[model samples]
Target: MIPDNEDRDDNKVYFFFTEKALEAESNGHAIYARVGRLCVNDVGGQRILVNKFSTFLKARLVCSVPGMNGIDTYFDELEDIFLLHTRDHKNPVIFGLFNTTSNIFRGHAICVYHMSSIRAAFNGPYAHKEGPEYHWSLYEGRVPYPRPGSCASKVNGGRYGTTKDYPDDAIRFARSHPLMYQPIKPAHKKPILVKTDGRYNLKQIAVDRVEAEDGQYDVLFIGTDNGIVLKVITIYNQETESMEEVILEELQIFKDPVPIISMEISSKRQQLYIGSASAVAQVRFHQCDMYGSACADCCLARDPYCAWDGISCSRYYPTGTHAKRRFRRQDVRHGNAAQQCFGQQFVGDALDKTEERLAYGIENNSTLLECTPRSLQAKVIWFVQKGRDGRKEEVKTDDRVVKMDLGLLLLRVRKMDAGTYFCQTVEHGFVHTVRKITLEVVDEERVEEMFHKDYEEDGPHKMPCPVQSSIPHGAKPWYKEFLQLIGYSNFQRVEEYCEKVWCTDKKRKKLKMSPSKWKYANPQEKKLRPKAEHYRLPRHTLDS
Candidate 1:
């Protein structure tokens, strides 16, 4: 059943019962509206107005015969005016006024007349004929009998002797005489079917409505009486002649037992909200595989890569089953090997040339040292590469001989002993199994130096240097000293020399610095300042 709240608040409700409303080409345009009613506002409260009928039957009848009586009862005030037949008559004739209250069989009426005769007759005694005299002469010889090929008397283009044959005769006459009148086709509409299973079963499983969520699938959410929510995916089955239902989620929220009154789904979130008699509950399925629900057995049986481990596939498990076995070691090994090979191929190709050169240098200087004993009791042999000798002799350093296990090995590693170490696992038969790795040891000095270099290269220091001083007569002393330091003493040569040196400094700083923020300052900044008297007296003043 649709929740009472859904129906109670008109503002929050949406009705989706037809195909046109969900069509992409229509662009959410409504083709037909409820009769005699207007859609004052859209779901989001936008105001729009549309006319129900463009033509009126009463207006058409009045325009056809100006002084006709009892014509209003057979004419619809809101019907669209389709045809005006004044040219066929000697005077004027009008038709196409549909009745609002009656069906086509009951209230439909039409009239035909000679244009010249109708005008003359209206001016004579016929215009004044009313009351008893008019009633008495209504069935007299003045009343015209239907005839063939005559506008006033034709019924299906044949002579109908009595009024009993009028309806059948008219239908035939309309079909035969296409020019005289044309049939109006009824508008196409979808059928309405109200579901009652949830209420009847006493379980809160009611499908309020079904909506197409694009061309792929139809989303259906059913509410239960016991505060249970079931989200179902429905696909149209042409062969079965019915929708194939797949349950996406079946959630129970009530601690006690309460019937769920209604449910709604958020297409954006793929979340389901279920409203019960007492409380409401929400279930979110983030990162849920929608296609997983369809042919879920295939996902479970055939695809070893995909597993049905969540609530959506939990239904496939037999009652009382709890544990699932782990994948075999052989499968794990194969999968890992394939992943490693793919990673090496892709990653190795894109490595920077400079980085590759550095790596090659490190590898050339490194030496692989195997244990002499080959196998030891309760002890593992680890090899470390110190550096290369001047003569290119490989320098082998034993990292540490430690007891087997990761915890014990980590405890023995000291500051001085840190380096790339490879632990060799040896069995009783003098067999050695090696896994090589390069470990880097970082000390406080190295870390600080790295930080200082980064600061000089990329931090505030690397920004454009501000002008230090402006001298009126001679060059500033600091500018002269800067020129001398850069091997240019003359003022004329200072600008060019300073530019090249500054550019070189910027490039070197960039190369030496890391992208990360520097944690250390330059050691030169820690030097003591010169005496105050040394700054107070200039070289020229001392010479004088």
Candidate 2:
């Protein structure tokens, strides 16, 4: 329940649901979303009404899109409602997920409403139906005393002690007229998020108010019919006074394609728990490592939970310890990687290493060079550095060679095609080198001969081709010892050595003290008096 300020601290109550429209519109019958409120102090009228609510009010909640000819496409079917509490206790933001019931248009929309706006709507003019024709119009006639839906309390200058003391005219007016003239409009007069795609039919939603570097952001975790939870946030552009919705991640929590029934977010623990019919799952608030370890990738992600921490792409906590308040770079508004990661990019391979591969093909056979980008939205760009002068040229598609989604394919492997290939991705105007590969075309007949010669020189475990690296003359590749340790004989030797070592850890002890310090510490009181003086109860005195 959300807080509603009234005369009493615990006097207000709110109810939300979808029901058939009472008044007929153009259509015969259609469901309309509504929010009704009641006051706890209302005691009904003494004469006209015996026992009923005198301060009950209700108004329509609009969630729709403007269509042609002034007709609005309404998402009238209510699916879920989430109240995101803010620092202001009385007025929490309302997030309502709605679906369109029209057969011609199937879509979902998320409408945001504020408590202040809703309160104002209830206090506006009341809708009245009069005359023989019974046309509904704003009641321009005189309103009854003390207002029809006003609560009787000290807040109104102690006007009326209770609804029982009010006149019969005011009490009867509230019973007959409950609808308000002005309906509550959404924040921006439109849905905050609208989806007309076929793959999505939103079911439930949970929102978390987050504090980031720039400002507070409301992150919404909406569950769908396909068992996927969408993590979305709204970015407000100050210059344009507009809101931009960004879907940061789409997590498939269930594999059975079942509907996600419920979702909960723990801001303290930084986790989201999702539950479906057959399964449940939990995920951390931020998966910083998925953004890649480069400063460019981290900044481009536009995730408020992560930032470039000078050394790596790490979780960014705006309320973290002082040590974490370092000058990390995060640009959520623009994701300007060139401005945020220009000279601050890591220099060594430890933090900024790219994926490398060694691909080989026979003299006449075909070969496929594979590349995988970090994001599905990225555009793959290929380049080749075949020139000896150390210049790179863009790889153009041809009859014998072609570029594909994941990589490039060669129809025929020729010795002249041997060179280093660079696979890069361009996304949001930022370029990143994701993969580097060296293409080698060897003779079909001499393949076995080359393997035999390398085996005799470098041992059978070595790679069939000559190893290439810039390692120091006396040192081997960093993984050489690891490769040697996995042999059959060495594995057994390692296992035998491990058997000689045993764990010395004890089960557990809540608290422990050393024997040497026991003498200096206070002695334990093992034996206590059966009846301590202070523990005895006070005796009662006889009274006359």
Candidate 3:
């Protein structure tokens, strides 16, 4: 019966028969028995006398080893000696003796079967000296008793021999002989030893072997006899000549010690649950505080993928986006506006929820200017005007400029003071950004006339004079017509004409004549003009 919480608090004992006992009973076998006397309600419940001197039977019997008589007599007095069968009754029985005599114990055995006809009868100590003695009866088959000191002795051998005068030579000869004892090959491998109580206190329990997970005992959580849980881990260092095992972390969980009765591990969740008589507590293996020795932070000082986020060091995805996610503040500038970007809205009386006021300045009716002079003493105010036609204008003023220093006053001044102001980092003196403000004074009336007037020849006014040239036919009508006569219509051609005309004194002397003088000159003289030479044909070319 499982005890209730109240019953447990009241210190009541609970007894439960396991499922294995029920299965054994269903098979018509006495598999469960209390050693010595069975307990009744208050005292010895019932005493069943077992005849210790029975012959071989095919089932196990439980009894206690008497302090005076020893092991052999104790086995001999059983009502039916059960020899377990193996290999289709072809193999010998295997016996396991559990000695609960005291704290120290040893137990295991192996045997082989022979034909019943060849087995020797037990004639006590005299049988070994005289050879086979008692006749073999069909009902009582002769079985050879293994020679003393032949098999490994679980206990001291002095208790076995009958007489003080008995020759010690036989026992000593048997001990020295190799053929006297047969080694018993264990059926299953030994279990792995896991230290669940965090520390290496397993030696106190005398547990020689324990099973490990897939032969890799990497992690060990030890629960102490007192409920303190210590976690120990074994790490293999390939760098060493012999890989060394080291314990990484040790933590004490309970303030006071209690006996840890059972330990269960959940690999899926990386959790360890320790069951104690008093309470059950769980320890998560990978929780920040319970990090193991092999943890990246504990072993490698700088984990590229992990960072300390104020409170704890945690692993994070190695992405630039994730880094941006953790940033506290971001400042963004748009045209002539600046704004502060926050991950979330701030809540509380300390923070203002209203939209932040922004200030701006306009120059030459064209350029827009803004500045963020982060300071506690000065506050800047901006005024903006928009006409009904949708044109915009702005002006800015600093309120607390009582007695500004030269540098501060110069910065506060408008476009006259504004060249391209570069943002210079205070620490490095590096130029970061260039802010340009250009200014020009404009005549408002002239600007309005220029924009509103139409000069497409549709107006009433005519040009002041006829738009034709006044120069005579042979004279240059401005420099452009002279250039056209010289085949210099394009800028490049004009440059070539100038180069050729200026190179000779004759051409220079002819160009020096005034327009009126060149026009009055004879056709022959006019043909002598440098520019006129390009249009006049040569005498030989006329004949051709």
The window of 10 residues in a row where model 1 has the poorest summed lDDT is: 535-544
TM-score of each model, in listed order: 0.21, 0.70, 0.21
- Among these predicted structures, which one has the highest TM-score? 2
Which candidate's lDDT is highest? 2
Q: Write the per-residue lDDT of candidate 3 for residues 140-173, one digit (tens) a residue.
A: 2232233322211222243322222123453333
Model 3 TM-score is 0.21
Q: Which of 1 and 2 is ahead in TM-score?
A: 2
Alpha carbon lDDT of each predicted model: 0.29, 0.72, 0.27
Which segments of model 2 are wrong by more than 4 Å?
1-6, 22-27, 43-50, 67-71, 130-135, 238-242, 319-323, 347-352, 357-372, 375-423, 436-544
Residue-level lDDT of model 2, residues 461-494, one tens digit each, is 6532223354457864333333232344545433
Question: What residue pairs are clashing in model 2?
Answer: none
User: Cα miss at 288, model 1 (Å)?
Assistant: 5.2
